[model samples]
Target: MISLRKLAPALCLGVALQGTTAMAEEVLFYHDKGFWSEALAKVGDASEAATGVKIAESPYSSAEQYKAFVQSSIASGKAPEMFSWWGGQSLNDLVATGKIAPLDDVWKTAIDSGDFPASTADLFSVDGKPYGLPMHIGKWAVLFNKDIFAEVGVEAPATWADLEMVAEKLKAAGHTPFAATVQDGWRGFIWFQELLLRTNPDAYAKIHTGELAYDSDEIREVFQLWSELFAKGWFTDVRSNREIEDFAAGGAGMYLIGDWAIGLLESNNLPIVKMGAFVMPNVDASIPPAVIVEGSPIVFSTEAGQDEAYIKAAEYWMSADGANVWGAASGNSIGNVNAEAPNEILSSLDASINEMGASAVLRWWELVPAQLQGELVAEFNSFMLDPTMEQAEAVMANIQALNAEYWADQ
Candidate 1:
């Protein structure tokens, strides 16, 4: 939990506190100081204005911090009434702890009303009972600089072969081929996920869900391809720079990142009008680009003895109207099947994304046993320091072994 001493004065003891001195009824809604949280606060505030419901706010950065706070609070019986969560094993673990409440009733209504996509809703279900709300059904799209691509004489790559050709052409023109910030370890995952998606999408999903071995030949191949890209100087070496700001500021040809990068691009005044998005270039065009559907799910709890208002708030969040409001506020695509996107660009993209999504698949990150994603990221970081042929294989093998033991213990 956030150290009480570190809490803002208003939360520590002042009137902003939603729960009483007895701390009986409160919903601790958390967000990191990012676009999503800020956007949530913006639209959620409007929701409150209309509905007169107040949710207590707590913020933290990094999933580790969020997990630490949640875990600590469970012991004190001061657990949050509801907070952002994800599906797969992550939600299963929480439910097993007996703190979380089932969302079957709300979800049944949502499904019947067509508020969310079934694909996304299924992620939050445990044994056919929904435990969380599906927020964003997003497909990873590579946002690139159109002006930069045009200047470099590179069209959006249609396939992995085409992408390699573009990267080489950019290098010949004396430009960095890709914008990557390997200094921050988690950032390395953009490349890893992209490569994994390209090489074998189903295998990628399986490994994450503990159904397949992480160190298998398929996983090894993905890592090897990543190391090969480094060997070809596809992106900057890790030692030279730690921040993507330089990469963005540099006249790099492309940045293989998710849609959220739009916020960063617009914030930097990078031209999105000239910027365009496409599925990450597949290593083999014969294969469809694997899209990752990543966003946080909101999980409620019975531990806090929250007032009926909290449950109503959770239901309100999953409403179709809430979807449009959330999408408008964040400038990000949402998962609601019935919620019409407010922006033309996002709507168009969403249409194409869903069309391809029917044939392609999403790699479930939240399903990966807890700590596996973190540990794999760490190993990838170590490789960034000095990517060797063995480094790639070693990384996957270690993760596979560790996870095998991890799941057995469960």
Candidate 2:
């Protein structure tokens, strides 16, 4: 059996829960809070006006916390009809519980209209059964500071070699080359994982499914490259220590983050002139390929208390108009397949991403199985902090061994 978790990967985006009044039929929602909740509320307001269902949301922090709440709720025979979340092993795991309602018709309508790429629908499917709607088409890039490059008398990095050159120059000037936050365990994974995408994509994917070992030659090359880069003093080493300027603080030279980083940038009143983004350079000799996370942020309506009205509201929240408002508020590109997102940032970012065309790469975290996620992340994290040749080999071998064990019965 082809493990659904390993087939297609991507993550997040959602809708509001319904309220109690006729215009406020609340939905029980567990979300990552902040923008997701606030943006979803706005989407719900428009949706309510258009569809007479008010979406109400109960917020939470982080996927792990939300999922734990969900597990306990289910154990107690309770689950929210629609909730917000990423789609990877995360969604597939939930689908396996037989609690999630498949939105086959909803997705088919979307696919038939060409509103969503087949990959979007594939993210939430398990065993050929559909489970969620397409809500975001991830727009990703490596965000950097224009001023920093100018200060160092360097141009914006145009390729992989450019990255190495820029890193060396920035280091010589004694400016932190990269700004990263490890307080959030997920953030570090972004660095190693993104590089792995350009370094060893196929083996990386296979590793996620327990097919290839983490210690494989391809995997070793990935870490060797990363370790060599770090040993060159390119990284800020803020993973163990707090960064001089975190992603939110805005003074760091560069950050490899989602397009949503633009929103955080703007909200801080930092001028866009202060920053820009570029694609990661390909290490492969087959020219260069752009990569990004392609799945939408979806609100999984698991039926909290009263999900009927809430689900309908969640459906409406995904409309073009609703998505546009979300895009504007996000100060980032709307991940929605049919998003009429109005923000200039989103438009500009979207235009840039489109130019990459078929070369854009989606992230591995979203495509790999749920069970294999933690293992891969941990191994990568080790390499990121104190990367070693031995650790690199062990990481790949451990991954391969784990993958073999994980899929042995499946």
Candidate 3:
């Protein structure tokens, strides 16, 4: 089992105190994005205006510190009124703590009014009870530079073969075919997940549940293809921290990332007209089309659920008006189906996804078991740096070992 005690003291001196006293007069909205303070403040203002309850925004500098503080607070029976959390296994682990309250009632209200799709409930639910609402929903796609593609005489690829052809063309034109890095450590899984989903999405879905082995032939094939790409010099230097900036400046041809990166491109002064996006084509055409979806959820504490004012504010946060306010302020795709898309790229991508009938799979980061996430990510990062057949074998071995141990105990 995951221990909450270890995280309690890590950030106690910095953030724990802030969550305590705010519960008296306001609903404390604690989250890890310090940069999102202004955006969240706007949502808080709107919530207050609608519900007559003040929503206080508390932003933490780093995810580690924020998680530590939230875990510690929940352990001490003093959990914050509201906080943002990742879905999938992370949310499942939190729900197991019994501190998070089921928001089935709130979700019902949203669904009844067509504010949120009923399917969204599955993302934040554990054992059939919903515990949170979506904060942001992003689709992972191939974000490419239109000018670079036009210059190279290549358009968006519609198949795995076409993608390779595009990469070769871009490389011959003196451009890196793709942006890739292990800079933050967690990013090693970006391509790993994408390739696996494109090649064998069924295996990708089952592997996280321990029903499929990490060292199986299907996974080995993914590594083989990845190694071939590395050998061809199709990726950016794994050590570089400027993946997005390089792609923005035309140093790279394509970047496979979530639609959320649109905001980063805009911030870097990359014109929206120059950006294009497409869902990755399947390596196995026999399989159904699929796109990865990442959903960040805002969970409420059981203690906070007792406060009528806070509950009212949370209800407002789930409404279309509240979603519009938050989406406009944050430049994010709101969970509410009725809310406007944050940008033209996202709007078009959503339409394409619907038109193609692509299956929406959860991103691997959240789908993987919480206990094995960091260790497995480290293995993948090492593999990205080496990317040899020899290293591929060792990486799969280490991942399977960690995965096996976690599932054995479960």
The candidate that wins on TM-score is 3
Q: What lDDT does each candidate get? A: 0.66, 0.63, 0.84
Model 2 clash tally, residue pairs: 46
Range of the 10 consecutive residues with the lowest summed lDDT in candidate 1: 1-10
**Weakest 10 consecutive residues, lDDT, candidate 3?**
1-10
Candidate 1 residue spans exceeding 4 A from truth: 1-27, 33-35, 75-77, 117-119, 209-213, 237-251, 303-306, 342-345, 354-360, 407-410
Number of clashing residue pairs in every model? 3, 46, 0
TM-score each candidate. 0.83, 0.81, 0.88
Query: How high is the lDDT of residue 234 in model 2?
Result: 64
Candidate 1 local distance difference test against the native: 0.66
lDDT of 1 by residue, 25-67 (tens): 3345765444466667765665565455544566776766767
Tally clashing residue pairs in candidate 3. 0
Model 3: lDDT to the true structure = 0.84
Best by lDDT: 3
Candidate 2 residue-wise lDDT, 117-214, digit = tens: 66666666778777765545556677777777888988766578888788888888877677765644556567767767777677656766666766
Clash pairs, candidate 1, are 1-69, 85-297, 137-335
- The C-alpha local distance difference test score for the whole of candidate 2 amounts to 0.63
Indicate the residue-level lDDT of 245 in model 3. 79
**By lDDT, is 1 or 2 better?**
1
